[model samples]
Target chain A: MPGEHPQTLTRSTVAVRSASAPAAPDAETLHEIHRQERASVTGAPVTAPLLPAERALLRSVEHAVLDERRLLTATELSALAALPDSAVMALASLAHQVRLTWCGPAVEVEGILSAKTGGCPEDCHFCSQSSRFDTTVKATPFLDTDEVLEAARQTAALGASEFCIVLAIRGPDERTLARILELVPLVHAETGLNVAVSAGILTKDQARRLAEGGVHRYNHNLETARSFFSEVVTTHSFQERVDTCQLVREEGMELCCGALLGMGESDEQRIELLSELQDLDPTEVPVNFLNPRPGTPLGDRAPVGAWEAVRWIALFRLALPGVILRYAGGREITLRDLQAIGMTAGINALIVGNYLTTLGRSSADDLQMLDDLRMPVAALTVAF
Target chain B: MTQLPAADSAPAFCTGCGQSSASCPGCGRDFDPPRYCSACGRWMGVTVTPSGWTARCKEHGEQHSA
Candidate 1:
C-alpha cells in the first residue's frame, strides 16, 4: 500500500475508527497528481489502428492509481488492455507490480463446484448453460446438501483454502438459498475451510444472510463491459449486476468480481470492464480468457492469445495496484506453453485444478508451475 | 446511446466474410496468408467490388481494401 505523507493522510482513517465518515482522497493535490497521469499514455509505442493520442489516453487510465485520476473514459480503457502481443505484455508486467505492492505474494487456492450445472435462463452468449444456445449440456437441479458437504471435505483434504459453491441459475430461489444456508455451518464445522458462493444476482437481505451463514465472499462476475454486456446477455441488465455487487459489499462481505476476455469484445471493452470493476473496489478479481465451449453462442469465438492474456494480467497489476488479480479459468488452454511465465507477468493468485464446467490441469502441474516461478505462496491465509 | 446487449441473437455469422454461414469455411484464414491483406484467407463479409475485396475486420470494423 502506498503510504500517504503524514500531513496528507486524511484524518478520515482515524475517523473511521471513531465513526463512519467518508474518507477524503487525502487532499485535492491528490486529484491534481492524477490529472498529470493522463500525459503518460502518450508515451506508448506506436501500433496500427491505435492513434498516439488514444494510446496516451489509455496509458493515463491504465496507469491511474489511488491518488491519480480514479477513473478512465470507457474508450480509453478499452484501448489500453486491447494492445497487440508485446505491448500487452509490458502493460501486464506493470499491472502485476501494482497488484504485488498492494496485496502480496499470497496465492489463494479455491475449489469450485457447479452445484447446479447447466440450465440457465439468461441469454448470455458466453454461457453454454443458457437454453438460448444449443449447448446440449444437461441441467441438474440443486445437489443434495450432504453431497455438497462431502465435496467441501474433499477440497479441504486437497489443501484448498476455500470452497466456492456455484450455481448456474440467475439467482438462488428461496428453496435453493435455504439449502445452501443449511449446509454452510456443516461445511464450516467439518472442513474448517473458508466458504464462498456464486449463487448469482443477490439482494441485500439475501447477501446479509449468506454472510451470516459463513459465506465469506460473494462472486458475481461483471462478465464484460457495460457497453458490451447487452450484446452478451439480454435477459439481465448491466446495472443489475452492479447493484448486486453493491449489495454484497453493503453486507460487509468481500466482493469477488472479474471478467471473461476473448468474446470478440474490443480492447476498449476489456479496459472499460476492468475500470468498472475497479470502481466497485472488489477484494479479488479473477481474470479469465474466453475458453469458447462448443455448442455455446461464443463457442466459435477464438481464445485470446497467450501473450495477450499475460499483458492483460500486467495491466491489471498496474491499474488496481492493490487488488487481488487471480488468474482463473482458461489458463491451461489459453496460456499453453507459457503457463508458468504468467507469474512473472504479475500474476499472484491462481485457481488450481478443475473449474466449474471444465477440467483444469492436474494439481501437480499447477504446483510445478508455482515452483518453477520460484514464488512461494504466502502462508498468511485469508478466509474471505 | 443504448448499449447493445452482449448476446447477439443472430446465429453465428462469419465476421470475416459476409456469408451468413454457420461457421467460417476456413477460406484464407489458415495459419499463414498474404501480409498485405489481413482477411485474405478468412471469410470476407463485403463483396469484391471493382476496387478489390472490401471487408471490415471483426475487431476494428474498419473498411479494408484488400
Candidate 2:
C-alpha cells in the first residue's frame, strides 16, 4: 500500500476487492466510508447528501445550462435563489462560468453626467434629489449645451464606452427635453461615444423622439420590486414605470432598467425583481446598492455586506445570463475592498468615475482594477 | 436695490471684476450651481437654508459652512 496519506487511500482501497473479500462496494458505500473518515479527522459530521428536491434543482440547472445551453425560466431561477447558504459557493461558481461563457473577459465602462440636479418632484425615499427629502443635495439648473459637451469630452477622455446624461425630475419638461434632444447628436458627432439618457419617465412620443435623435439607450430604473416599491416611493405607481419601459422598447431604443438592492426588501422580493427584469429583457441591468444619503428616509439603513453583495450579483447573472450586468452606485461604499470579487460574481460592466449625486472611485483606479484582473475594457459596440 | 432677472435668465455679473459671475467665487467660471467648493475646487453639492449655505464634498464632507 503506497500510503502517501491514509485519507487519500481510503477511496481506492475500497474500490479494490479480491474474490474472498466482500462484493464490489456500491457508490453509496464508498460515500459513507469517506464521510466517516472525514468525521474522524474533523471530529464533526460531514454535510448530509443533497435532499431529493435539492438534487433535482441542481440537476435541472446543470441540464439547462451545461447540456442544453438554454436560459433558465423564472421558476428555475427562483429555485437557484432558494438554494441553501452551503450551496451558495456552487451557485456563484456557476454564475461566474455563465458570465464568462456569455460576456467573456471584457468589462464595459460607462460614465454618467448629472446634467440636471436636485429639485425632483418625485418622492423616491432613497434619492437625495427628491424635493420631499431634506438631503444636502442642492438644486442646479440644467447645464448649458457647452457644459454638457465638455462633460461628454471628459467621458471619452476617460476611455468610457458610453456616456449618459442624467436629469433629476419626475419627467422632463418640454424645454428640458428639447435641449437634450439637441445635445444628443452633438455628443455623438463630437465625441464618437455611445449616448444614453435618463430623463425620468417617458411618454411614447418622447421615446420615439429620443430614438430618432441618436440616443442609443433609455434608462429608467424600476428601483425595486413591485411588491416592495410602494414602501420606497409613494408618488408614482410601479405600473407607470413598467409602461415607460415598454414604450422605450416599442420605440426601438435599448432599455437600461434595474433596481436598487438592500432597500429593506426581503430575499424573495429581490428574486422577484430579477424575474421582472428577465421579463423586461433589458439590454442592460444596472445593479445599484442603497447608498442611503443622509436626510433621506432610508439613510439609517446599513450598507450591504461584501459577501452578500457578491451573492446578489451572482444571482443577477444567473437570473439574466445574457444581459449586460453593471456595477452602479453604492459599490464603493458597500463592496469596498471586495469590489473585484463583485466583478467576478457576474458584473461585466462598470459605471466608471462619479455617479449622479455621489462620487465614485477614480476612473484610473477602475481601469487599473480591470487590468489587474486581466480583463480588457470593451470598446464601443452596438451589440451590448 | 436692483431687481434680479428671472431665475431662468442669465446670472448677474460679478460686482468685483465686472464679468459674468459664476457661483463659485474662487473659479469664476460659468458652471451649473450650487457651485464647486471655493477652497478645494471639488464639486460641492450645496444646500441653501434660511440661516446660511452648507456645501458638501464627497472627499471632504461639509467643506463650507456659512
Candidate 3:
C-alpha cells in the first residue's frame, strides 16, 4: 500500500453489479455536498419525493447522453447533483450504462513515476511537492536513466500500457526538456508503453517538441473550476493551465486534462468544471479526490467521502461520455474497501501502480480487481 | 506491500531519498510512519493523523516521521 507522500496526491464489469451499492449515505457518512448550502440549486428538499419535474429532468439528461449521444448542459448536471442521496444509486446505474454504451468495457491501466520528486517552484496548495510549504517531503533530482528505465519496466510488468513521467516543476526548462525527450524514447523502447508527461505548464514550442518526440499525451490538471481556483493557489492562474492544455492539443498530442475535487468547492462549481470540460474535450479526465496533505493549505480539510466519490465518478462519466474516466489519486484513503463500487460507477480507466507521490493499491490487487470483474486490461489510443 | 517484515528484520531504504537513514533531510515527508520496514521491504502497519503518526514494521518496532 502506498502511504500518502505523505503528499500526495478500476474496473471492471460490463454489467451492473449492484444497483444500490452506494445506497443512501447515513448521517455519519453524509456527503460534503450536504454539509453546505450549495445543493440548493434545486428547489426540492433532500427528503422530497422525486417529483414529476425532477424525474423528467433526470430522464431528459439521460436521453441526451444515452440516446442522442450528446453532452449534458450545466443545468442538467446540476439536476443530477441536486438529487436526493437516495437517487445517487440510480444516477450511478445510468452512468454505468453510459460508460458501457460510449466507451466499452476494456479498462486502461497506467503506472506513474515521479521522475523528479519534490522542490516544485509553483505552489499548488493541494500538493506537498511545493518548496514553499513546510512539508516533510524530501526533494530529489531527476532519476537516472537506468532508474527511469527500471521504473518503466516495472510499469510494463504490471500490465500497464501507459506510463507517465511526472516531474514537480512549474514547467520544463531546456535541461528538463532535454532529459524528458531523451527518456521518452528509451522508456518506449524498453517497455513498449505509451509515454505520457505531466511537467506542468508548457509553451507552444515546447508542446510541439514533446509531441514530435513521441510523447503521446500530456497531463495538466485544471484542479478545480475557474470560479474557485484563486482561493487555493495564487502562484498561477487557471488560464495558464488551460493554455498548456490547448497547446498540447494544438501540437497534435492527446490532452489529458483533469480536476481535483473536494477542496471546498460547491456542487455547482463542480458542475461548472464538468461544463467547461465539455468545451476543452480532453481524451482523458483523471478524477482525483482531495486526500488532504498535511502541512499544506488544504491539510485540515476533510477528505471526500467514499460514496460521494463514487457519485462524482458516475457524474464525470455522464458529463463526458466519450473520454477515458480514470480513477486517479487519493482513492485509497477516500474509497478504502468500497473501491470496487467505482468500477461499476462509470470509471473506465485507472492508474494501476503507484501515483506521483502517493503509493497506490498494489498492482496485483488492481489487476485482480479487473480479473474478478472480468474486465480485461487494454491500452487506449484516442484521437486528439 | 504484501508481506510484513519480521521483527528485527532489516530496515528498508526511504522511498523518498532511497536511503536507509530516515533522518535524511530529503526523506519522510507525507508518509505515515513507514509502510514497509526500513531494513526490509515488508509492509508495515502505519496510522497517521493530525496530532501524531505511527508506523510499525512488526519486526523493527515503530518510528514516527522526523
Candidate 4:
C-alpha cells in the first residue's frame, strides 16, 4: 500500500520534471535571457529597437537631448546596457545628451602640479607614487610656493580654466599647508585660475581652510565602488575617502570625485561607483582610465578599451546629469582615435597636457582636438 | 614616538611646530593637532605617531619655507 502511494507520487514527480525540463530555447528566448542578464549587469536596460517607456524616460531627462534616466540606486543602475551593439549605441547616445546638458559643448582644460611628488605612505595599488611601491618616480619634498605659483601661471597662460595642486603623501603637514595658503592667494592674484587640490586624506578643519584660502575645488576620489574598494587599496578604508569628500562638501568647496576604470573591477562595480557619485552629486567628476603605471599592482592590467571609455563617460553624463565630467589621466595613452569622440560622448572637461608623473597629450593638441570636434571652449565658472 | 617603547616618553613633539605642546600652527586654536591643524592647515609631511596621529585638518596648506 505504501509502495502504491509512492508510485503515484513518483509518477507526478516525473510529470512535473518533464514539464520543468530545460527546453532547447529558441533563438528569441535565448536573446531575451541574454538581454535580461546584460541589463542587470550594465544597468542600461535593453529594448526592442526602441521602446516607448525607455524612450520617454530618456526624452524627459533632457528635453533638447536624449540621455537616458540614470538610476539613483546601485541595484537599479546595475542593469543598464544589457543589450548587444545597437541597444548599447542607443543608450550611449542618450548618455551623450545628458552630458551636454551639464557640461555644455566645450572641453575645459586644467593643469596638474605634483606639488609634493612621491613617497605616499598609503598603498593605493594603482598609484606608482606610493612609498610601498618601487616605482622610480623621484620622491621629492613639497615644492616651493613660488614654484607652484609659477606652474599655475603657466597653465593659466595656456588658457586652462583650473590648476590642480596634488601631493603624494597620506596628507600634508602644517608647513606644507601654510605654503599652500600663501601660494593659493598669490596664484589667484597672479593667474586668476581656478585652483583645485588633491592632498590625500583631509580632515574637516583642512577642508574649511582650503575653502577659505580660495581653493575652488577639492578632489577626493572614491577610486572605485564601495564593493570593489578593498580589492584596490587595503591600507586606507573606503569610508575614509567618503568622510573626506563629505568634509570637503561641508567646507563649501566644490567636490571633484571620480573613479579609475580597468583596475580589474567588474561592470557592476563601475555602476556602483556611478550610483555612489550620483548620491553625492559632486560639482566635478574626473574619470580616470587606468594606465596601469609600471611598478604598481595594476601595472600588468591592460587599459580599458576605447568604447568602454566612451560608454562609461556617456554613462557618467547620464548619471551626473549636471556635473563637470573631466576626461582625465590616460586619455591619450588609452583612447587614441576616439579622443574627440569623447567630447560628443558626454565628456565636457579635460585635463590638458601632462598628468602627475605621467606625460599626457600637449595643451596645443588638446585645443586642436576641441577645434576639430567643433566643441566650444567655455570657462569653468562655479559659484565656489 | 617613543625612542624605544619607554611606555612614558613626554609625547613626541611636532617636527613642524617644534614645541613640546605645539598647537596646529595654522589655526593656533586647537590644543594639540586633531591630526594636523585645526584651520587653514595644508598637507604637511606625514608623521608616524606611536599611536597614529589625529587625521590632519582638511584645509591646512603647506607653508613654503623661505
lDDT of 2 by residue, A251-299 (tens): 9998999879988998878878887887898888999998877679998
Candidate lDDT scores, in order, read 0.65, 0.73, 0.76, 0.67
Interface RMSD of each: 20.3, 12.0, 10.9, 15.6
Fnat measured on candidate 3: 0.00
Better of 1 and 2 by DockQ: 2
Give me the runs in candidate 2 sitting further than 4 Å from their true place: A1-59, A84-86, A380-384, B1-66
For model 4, the stretches where C-alpha displacement exceeds 4 angstroms are A1-76, A381-384, B1-66
- Top TM-score prediction, candidate number: 3
Better of 2 and 3 by lDDT: 3
| Candidate 2 lDDT for residue A40 | 35
What value does the lDDT take at residue A168 in candidate 4? 83
Evaluate model 3 with DockQ and give the value.
Answer: 0.06
Best by DockQ: 3
**How does model 2 score on DockQ?**
0.06
Q: What lDDT score is found at residue A101 in candidate 1?
A: 55
The Cα error of candidate 1 at residue A11, in Å, is 42
Q: For residues A1-384, what per-residue lDDT tens digits would candidate 3 score against the true structure?
A: 243112111121111123323223232223343424335545543333333334344555666776677787776677677666656676777888888888888899888888887789888889988998976554667878987887788788888898889999999999999999999999999989999999998999999999999998999999899999999989999899889989999999988989999999999999999988888999999999897886899989998998788889988988999899898988888888978889888998998766765667666788899899888899875521
Count of backbone collisions in candidate 3: 16
In Å, candidate 3's interface RMSD is 10.9
